[model samples]
Target: MADYLPRAPWTQRDDLHRMVDALGNAPDGTSLARWVGGAVRDGLLGEDAADVDCATPLKPQDVMARLKRAGIRTVPTGIDHGTVTALLPGGKVEITTLRRDVSTDGRRATVEYASEWRDDAARRDFTINALYADPRTLEIYDYFGGLADLAVRRVRFIGDARQRIREDHLRILRYYRFQARFGSALDSEAEEACAELAAMLKGLSRERVAMELLNLLGLPDPSDTLLRMEQRGVLGVVLPEVQRPAIEALPTLIGAERQAGLAPQAIRRMAALLPLSPQVAEGVAARLRLSRAQRDRLACVAGRQADDAANPLALAYRCGTECAQDRLLLCGGDPAPLSDWEIPQLPLKGGEIVQRGIKAGPEVARILRAVEARWISEGFPDRERVLRLLEAELPA
Candidate 1:
């Protein structure tokens, strides 16, 4: 029992109090209290808290009713699991009733509500995430030695690692992400468990696996973890096309420091390593439920190789400004140097070519391409030079 006052800002403290007050007035004796997750870990690490999740003894319906009484919008985010999302001005808070897993098929779990906080913490994936904090007092309640594991920077599963993985195969990838993000060392039991259950990852849906892999790549040193997963045959089973060549080339493709930024460009750089066909990539993206923009950007990056930078202006023009910038950054190129060259704007249009008696066919496109190439070669001269080139190419 570590007594730490709630160090969250006044606004957050007020919000928590608001929720707790609402929970207190609910029909059931259940009251809202802070539960384990990023809030507790980030509070201890002095990192900015992104989301606050609370646990209440009240059932989902009761929680919703209380929120309605408080004039807060409540969404049934996971009604089956007794989770409701409360929308707030700055951010949203997810409040879930304490639950215990009754049955699980390593994909989804069937849960039953519990009145005790210890039951909820015990059911979580890792110990570091099992520590709960009091919303009003900000006191931490550790049912397991999560605080000890956090202080020692060790990632230990709550119960048996193998059993936990069988409960949810996605935890394997989550374990890697946690290790990479928190800079924690994995215990032998956990490591062995990961290796043993690596093959079970195939049972997970591609979308789920993809989401977890993306999160893993967001870590500081995802490469090492990815390599370990690959060595243990987990990567191949889940993603068969990601071979050693591409994995080895990832470090060179995107430096570790930049990849740690967790930008879309970093994701693209890493995705390029997979030897997936265009159709396969599209399928994978669809299965993973990736946004259209993400799929397109990743496809664009994968289509181009490092040695394809012979025509810098053409590359910039084809890839657009942002993608070009990302590509340069991924390749460790100085973006400042290339920032000055403006994309060559054509002076003449297809209509102008037709007006000049040139056919509106392949030749029109060829003429424009030639003029644009000449403009680029001449270091993108003034509009006057562009006009002159267009005039020369399509003389009236």
Candidate 2:
């Protein structure tokens, strides 16, 4: 055991103790033990805990009963892996029974429940993630010297890198994401492992690979790791049509954070670097599970590049406030504080045109466009200028 600090909050510690106490009364073959992932690693790294995961000695049914008796709501998030999500006041904890891989098809693992934490730790992906914590004492259980790796900021696979990559090809993308997010330096062994198995990424679903790539790009500094993936031939294999020029421009495009202050928009900026059609860009958004706003913004940015119209009112009306601002920022337009571009509102409507005896056909739309053009050219001053333009275009 290594010396560790109490990085978790008092509430989290109390919750863990409550869980352990409840498990202490569990019947034979229904006990609980803590196990892998973010909860343990983030705690040790002094980062805020997001989700807590555990391993129960109890079988799935038994674990459900015990957690229910303890008044914790249980969700069958993944029963196949003997995992149950126990909902607590502050957050939810994922508790899985100790298991060893019975079989794996390189995409999913078939696990067999065991009572030993060591067995479960051996089956995990990375050393740091394999670390477990004792809720009662707040002491970390390090079966793989994950503490040492954490201290040095190195990311290493639990065992053979190739074997791990072969087990799940998604780990290929995850490796770079981890390196970019937490790991200070990339391990040569890990890099070589990825290079050897880069083509295996083709075996994974495009949706899964696209999600991982989007997540990797969302990181603060993903350029180096992305470049590494590119060198390993993974990029070409996964998104073959994505040109090299855009890939090369990723560093500069994503380096300056956009003003939206959202990760998905940053992702859109990176995607915009690619020479893709609006339809292809929309497809990419759907493939990556990007939110609707992200999809719309990406389409708008792609379309805006081809539009040569400099009319402020036209730009504002089409792009809306948020996207218009984002576009101006990206195009190196003057940042004279957003207040300077107040768009003049149109007082006249299609109803007003009809009242003025203007025919309601394609000509109605044409006249409106003409009126807008004159308004835009006149600096879009006030309502008077707008009305004058409307009158000139739609006179009875």
Candidate 3:
């Protein structure tokens, strides 16, 4: 029900008040600081905003000096970029000076501070993100039609869509991400602009692209937005390795994940969007510059084919609990056995087998492996039963 004003509880916290109070001694607290960007946008939606950022007309150094004079602790997090972080008792607030982009190269932008609030808002990517709130006035400021856009769940570019994208190609990915999280549907103009300039995405770093795509995949159900991206050729521009068949298989995995009471993971969903081939998964993972652990996990689930009736606990012991769940859900296998089962290490050892009168050589190792295999096949029996099984492996 918040409109034209933000009623976020974090704004009323005493720590935040202390931080803002340090910014200025104005009677109404104007001309000092106002909450900006995601905090304001999410707050107005009746959601608890985790990150509370602010904008001030004062330069970063001056703001730091003021905070220090008021006994406030400040970190020069991005001082060169006109951003300073004020540590409050409740949380840290990122205080950035109002700035306008001086130039952009479709990757990074050079910015210069400006006194006018609108100048700062103009440089933002989307209208809904341009919302701002004055701490003292208790009034929300909409330089663009952000409030109206929020009302209709529409995400529109601040100015020309193509120009906004040209300024930074990352906006194309951001548009889809925002649409998946906030907007009820895709904006045709924004979608078309992204398609027209989709090639510019090649200019971005692989890390950034992977981050956005993984974030999108992490959503509960991004099937519609993903399908739109595929239709628009936007997804293909970044990840051509994902063929249509694999992408189509995502919904089934999503449903299986839901039925099995498991949360959707970004990497798991990404693994679902590829053929069941470890080689293919490894190749795509390397291209995206994924971390070693992530690359290995993708490989683990990619080549695996889980039977619906297979022992999920055994699979968990083999690859990992997470990988087992992923393979089962992706392959239409049941993972209920892992719900309460605790994976146990083999109780019998090679030394125990050697003491059973077997030669202390290759045959002992072979017997130990055979006994371990039998133990696993029997669903991991007690230590006594394992010893008996090892006795059976020894030469008579």
Best by lDDT: 3
Count of clashing residue pairs in every prediction: 0, 0, 0
A best-first ranking of the candidates according to their TM-score comes to 3, 1, 2
- Worst 10-residue lDDT window for candidate 3 reads 1-10
Candidate 3 local lDDT, 1-396, one digit each (tens):
444556667878888787788888445537488888898888878888979899998999999999999888999999999999999888899999999999999999999999889999999999999988887666888988998898889989999999999999999999998998898855778989999999999989999999999989998888778888888889899888777777777898889889988888999988888777899899989988999999999999897864624777778888888788788887788888888877899897777766666668998888878987898889898999998997787777
**Collision count of model 2:** 0
| Rank ordering of all candidates by lDDT, starting from the highest | 3, 1, 2
lDDT against true structure, model 3: 0.86
Question: Once superposed on the true structure, which residue ranges of model 1 sit more than 4 Å away at CA?
Answer: 10-12, 25-31, 252-266, 275-289, 306-313, 330-332, 337-345
Candidate 1 lDDT over 1-396, as tens digits, reads 355634757325566677678777335433366655888887777777787788877889988998899988989998977989999775788899999989999999999999888998888999889878766567788877888788878889998899999999989888887887775566889888988888888788878887887877655456677777788777777767678777776666556335434343545645655654556666656767788986776666555557535555666777765556556655555455346777656665777767878888998898888888888777677888877898888745
lDDT of each: 0.74, 0.70, 0.86
Error of 1 at 391 (Å): 2.6
lDDT of 3 at 81: 94
Better of 1 and 3 by TM-score: 3
Q: Model 2, stretches more than 4 Å misplaced?
A: 10-13, 25-31, 258-266, 279-294, 306-316, 321-326, 334-346, 374-385
Lowest lDDT 10-mer window, candidate 1? 256-265
After TM-score superposition, what is the CA distance of residue 268 in candidate 2 from its true location, in Å? Answer: 1.8
lDDT of 3 at 178: 91
